[model samples]
Target: MTDTDNVSRRRFLQATGGAASAVALAGCTGGDDSDTETTTTDSGGDSKERNLKITWRPLDTLDPVASTDSASGWVIQQVNDTLANYKNGAVEIESRLATDWSIEDNTKYTFTLAKDAKFHNGKKVTAQDVVYSFERLAASDSSRRASFILNDLGVKHETKTVTKDGEEVEEYKPNSLAVNAEDEHTVSIELSEPFHASLPMLAYTSFSVIPEGIIGDVGDYEGEMSQKKFAKQPVGAGPFKFDQWQQDTKAVVKRFDDYHGKVPEVAGVHWQLISDDTARYTYQMNKNADMFNIPTSKFDPNKVSVEKTDDMGRKHGTYGPVRNGDTVNFGRVGGISNHYVGFNCEKVDKKVRQAFAYALNQETVSNNIFKGRSKPAQHFTPPAIFPGGASGYDEHAKKYPYDSSKAQLQKAKELMKEAGYGKDKKLDITLTTYDANVYIEISKLLRDKLASAYMNISVEPVKFPTLVNRGRNGKLEVYTLGWLMDYPAPDNFLKLLYPPKTDTSKKGMASYVNWSGTEAAKKATEAWDKIQANTKPTEEAQKARNEAYLTMEEANWEDAVMIPLDHPYEDRMSYDWIDVPMFGGAGRSRQMLNTAKFTGKRN
Candidate 1:
């Protein structure tokens, strides 16, 4: 679910009832057969300079932390700048607000801010603001709820001093405050534990630094999620400044001339909430929309006349040949996401789950159903982190490779028999899914495959939020959904599913499927403790972390706690003549469009 920014495309689509808004789904934008005339700022006849028309499916919220969908993260990208930047599909790290940074023993990271960065409010950005931004993410202050960064840091600050090898060193505290400003320009972030994930984790959207003055107000966070004024009217130190946001309608932003980094060439950006996919695609096909999630039909070359090519020269069908239909442009990057089917572990028997996992045919779905638009997932983490290689550390012993052979089904049937569902007894299960063309089809696939195992699966299609809510309430036997990665890391994928611990006090599985009570869950929890205890913030630490995560994943495959579906390939397309630098990968930070330039229209 690269919508993951894509999943967001569908979240608000059903609600919009109009043109395609931002891909409110995890990142997959849907198209309606409805057609609507559209227009871009570009005038014809060689006068190519114009405003960028960025269309999306819909946006339910403007609040960054409260933004449950990736489309909102897309909005945050245009307005806010995080600590650093990701380029070439998150393979390289470039300087953004921070000019230089260093890490000590993987527990501490010091970032030096670029002097020229200024907020649209004309406030000078300082280390104090950065520290405040990070702290706010984990703060329990009632103004709002932050989803991404809190997964990394706890709600409260804890710290302690200890002696180590004849020297005093700070140890992980229960409620340790992790980030602080050493001086005006130097921001020091100290984790309680040797959390090697601080770098990539900081790259998430919710980690975007805002002016301290904005959030420093006494009542800044004391309001309902949507009513938080600061969240709606965001101020940031990025190339684009928020102009206007009409919820579910459109969002507008203009260039921030005082931006410290590379500036955007387009005078402003206009994101229209087009709910219908076909209309959205037709408009982009006619060059009305400058950038959008290219519809699945657009990927079909015969359906549209796309003649441009990315520098790599891959056809636009799946890899992206930027300009097609009326000669548009595109930015191509493999999606940094993992789509999965979450099982309610507390209710599901391990053998039942294992049998279900073995029966899934993700390869056929990714290739045949998604038509090469997605990669068959081998593990929970996205293979995109390594850029076109295997997505896991290594194939583990419990790997349930995609095998549709009768022998595999026979084994599954044998497992079912142990559960007493084989023979005349049919295991009846209700599967919940979001109402999207692809999701509906996926549910059907699951139903079809499980039939051979004598499992009666019923598919119930509902809205994305409702499906998520049901997962929280433990209402469904199996739920079809995708969790987008905030950043590229195994922790981002593992921690949410099998948390080190589960707090029943927090409602709805704490945004995870509540896999803590099972044996597979216990093993995964144990693996996390090992990763935190032994791993450092280095290549060796990554190796250790990978090994640990692979074990945990293998265990899950064996237990069938959760079933991984696929990692949908993500793409950002525009007219080739647009000359805009582009990014759409794992980290939401990559969607920042500051450095992009609009070079006239197509040739």
Candidate 2:
């Protein structure tokens, strides 16, 4: 039977719990009649209230160039307009301001503008604005948002041009970081060589052109944009306009009447910053909100407006009905995101790292804690993102196995003995986790496994801010973090971990990953340099990336750096009124929102 015909709304909710990455069950029953009803309410002019309650934290900033963090990006995504965007498993090339473009040469791209596109302030978006935004990002060394753009295209430092080549072949002024605008409507982006992913690179929200007048006045834009006043109160050219922002509470957005494309279906969108999962689920259960995920404790398929369930959970959990509601299953997981538990390489012993790996059982952890809500992640990329991806690298094969037994226990004990920790000795370590039951379970499993090897593990639940600072400062023993791909390219994940640079150029965000400065990391960094210098996106570059990834992975393991673990399954629930594109991450896929016409009715 067709998906709509057999799948019950309750069954779907019970199985996936509105998780975008949850596994889909087959032959379930329950239709999304609620969503239909909600959409009908909106389209039929029942009420103009378009409020969406989400379980995400508040945004950090509003500036497109400054808001590189997920929270900030979430807000700016609605308020700012990029030159291009990714959605629906494809990058839909639309005329934000620049309608079309032509590759003038390997190093140059010229874009033609659409006269109609205008900023929310009523000023026309011009080439000058584009050049200004880029230049501003380049000038600020702290601006991580500009790395993708600046790295793809060559940047000039004071009185010298930093070529992609090993040789610094130029003498220039300090204005080197600036993008030169050739004309009002047309501009040329010149690089030392052709970067294959430049087009998609431009599609990032960071590349969204801003008003030239704003940045030209801001003095010494050298620090994090999130700290900038402009980022706190920014202007943009998007379908929505920034209204007001109350930190730790909410960010209000009003529909832009002068939006160039199709006007928004609802009058306004209320992005409520609700951090408590229980609270969000409670609201969803009570119908206070038309649709949302049901909390783990409160999830019930029978009480919901719809029902859908299938066998995706049985394969992992080995129990429960074939389906459930508003739950992220432990087994069925896809989409290109990778989540790994990493260890500290600087302070931990190599043998201890391997022992930890051997002690951890991904399958057991997946089934028990995740409840079939995630997949066993092996690498940075998933099979869905590339060819042979699911089966691509054999790196994990080189290390520990999930088979825990008496023999395995002896081996782990032996390793600990060699590492100077045995029955009489113990290693003290702090493991970091976000304040979540899911992570708590993972932490406990890790602690138990490590304890088997005579390691004294302590769980430290740090606030999100403290966690970010500690991770960036390289001040943790072991921390669990998830890496979601910014784009559909390997470079997005690979390069961000170790970007290329010149001997004179200052260090950048890649330092966050290579905090140890080991010889292997240095080599991987060199490989990144070579990849950047390469002219084409050929097999040679791919091979180089593969080599870099292997070297980095090995170094991380050998040095007892971050221990990589299995990726958990993710899921998303939709209110009957909302039609989120079933392609990738909710906001990551730009196309998901492209065809979403909000109906006035409540589903």
Candidate 3:
């Protein structure tokens, strides 16, 4: 439902560094003495002048059209305003840029722009801006999410043949997309078919409205700036404005006074790029960061005391009294994502893939590696978005359950032997993964477990970006990656395994397993086609769609396309004085500090 660059879809956990090394480096105590030098007040005598500080990993591009990862999306959410957005802590969509919208015939959508909405540039938002934004999103070569508009949403568009160099090639007709500025403040969009998830899909950052004629790439009118400049210093109608970005160091955004919504109480937000687990932990313990994540290496279950759990499965608690003697508020929610070991189906035989899947135990990984902080994932789709929701996940999970039992190990050995591999003729393959300590540890476990199954597994640790590039180029025989939800829908997760997305020629970022040429692929393709056909909101249609999801998942199980490891829990540690949004199924990337309030002094 959401469009992201292939790399964006692959989310990296915040925790880095080995557990032993991290604990040894920082101890179970506080930060350095020098880190305690805190500024209590600003020139205006407000203690909140230092603003809210958060630790994050390195970000990719900031351009909404080009950004695919959650790192960039988090900052983008601050500087951009989409037509609709997920309500905080919930998947329900709410109006943002548009005051309200109406749907007709389940295909056509009409939105009435907020009369008071104004861009950071002080220009009034209009229907033309919305039209231009959607058009650019579809036509711009830089847009990784163009498919979300053209294909996934089934937006009506026309193509025309134009001669380039010596041959003729087809491209979208200028302004031919089925979006129209009906008036100064009304915009209408027509879809090729009725899509049940259209509203939620529109909530993605890719549909964020920017001033029309700002860039020269999509339309003939170009006035403001180049695409590159806009990416670095974007102007939007959100509550925050782009301040500065220093590559791998940090990015800052200042509050916009003229924001249409309730403005942020703080002066700005400072996102510190701290990739080291110890450093992030120390920074938070020192009270330098108002809100941050507690690395698994530094997390102690005994220190956590849960007060209650919400209906949405969010746990509210307090964690603390560390060596620094600080007790911070804590929150935990099941993440809408799945981390897995993917096989290149074109290079690895199906039986070998199945053998590896059976050999690796998800429960062991969840317990030993994640320390019970995550749930074992049996299906590619996380339970929150699985067909029929979390209630039915266990039923479908029974279709293909892989455990580390002796019997399963025996089954794995048999599969490997049937694939013409044995102790003497072991099938050698390398699993490339992000150079994070957790992933490396998981890979090593997998290597050790598969050894008995006559599979010689080598673990290759690379930077996150490098891992993504290798997977995209089909240079990896096997790899470790994870998919975060772009939207809360079964189709969003299922579409990743859709057969056509496996076509390297089309530059598919998902389905690195490339099972497009196998019999399982044929069955999956049939189910995928059916899923597309049953997009209507009728009860029968929804039932048929759920059945298709199961069929496709069964096909994946039969082929062992990928091994679903575990669904991690998103945990947050923040000073009790700082009230942060408990973003549950809505996703952490959409966490907005604008609504956050400073309730009391940090003791």
Note the Cα lDDT for every prediction shown: 0.61, 0.54, 0.76
For model 2, the superposed segments whose C-alpha errors exceed 4 Å read 1-49, 88-95, 152-174, 215-227, 290-333, 393-410, 496-507, 511-523, 543-551, 554-557, 568-570, 583-595
- Decoy 3 TM-score against native: 0.89
Q: Which stretches of candidate 3 lie over 4 Å from their true place?
A: 1-48, 160-174, 404-407
Name the candidate that leads on TM-score: 3
Across residues 1-603, which tens digit of lDDT does each residue of candidate 3 receive?
A: 222211110120111113212211111012321221233343433534546678887777788887777888888998999987866735656668877766677777888888999999999999999989998888887787887888778899998998766767666676889999999989989999887678778888888899999888887876588888888888888988888887767788888888888788776777887667787777777777778877777778788889998666688898888658988888887877888888888899888888878777888788777877788888888877676566688777876756533227788899888999887999889989876667888999878888899988889998666776677777789888887777767788888788778654344355566667778889899998998898886679989998999988888888888778888888888876777678856567876668875666554
Sorted on lDDT, best first, the list reads 3, 1, 2
- Over the full model, what C-alpha lDDT does candidate 1 score relative to the true structure? 0.61
Candidate 2's residue-wise lDDT over 525-548, tens digit each?
675666566636456766665565
lDDT of 3 at 572: 84
lDDT of 1 by residue, 1-603 (tens): 232122121232243222111111122321321222222344452322345666775665554555556767777877888887554324244567888876554455678899888998898999988866765665534213343444354323544787756767543342245577899999877655565445556666677888774654322443222326766787888788888777656777777778888776666667776655566666566555656666664465333333454443223432233344243443444566767777766667777777777777777768766766777766776654421235232333224554522225677787888888865889888888866557778788878877888889899987665675566565767877776766555666676655533332243234445566666677777887767665455567777776677767766775666677788766566655554554545533356665556555433
Q: What is the RMSD, in Å, between candidate 1 and the native fold over all Cα?
A: 10.0
TM-score of each: 0.78, 0.77, 0.89
The model with the greater TM-score, 2 or 3, is 3
Q: Please state the error at residue 488 of candidate 3 in Å.
A: 1.1
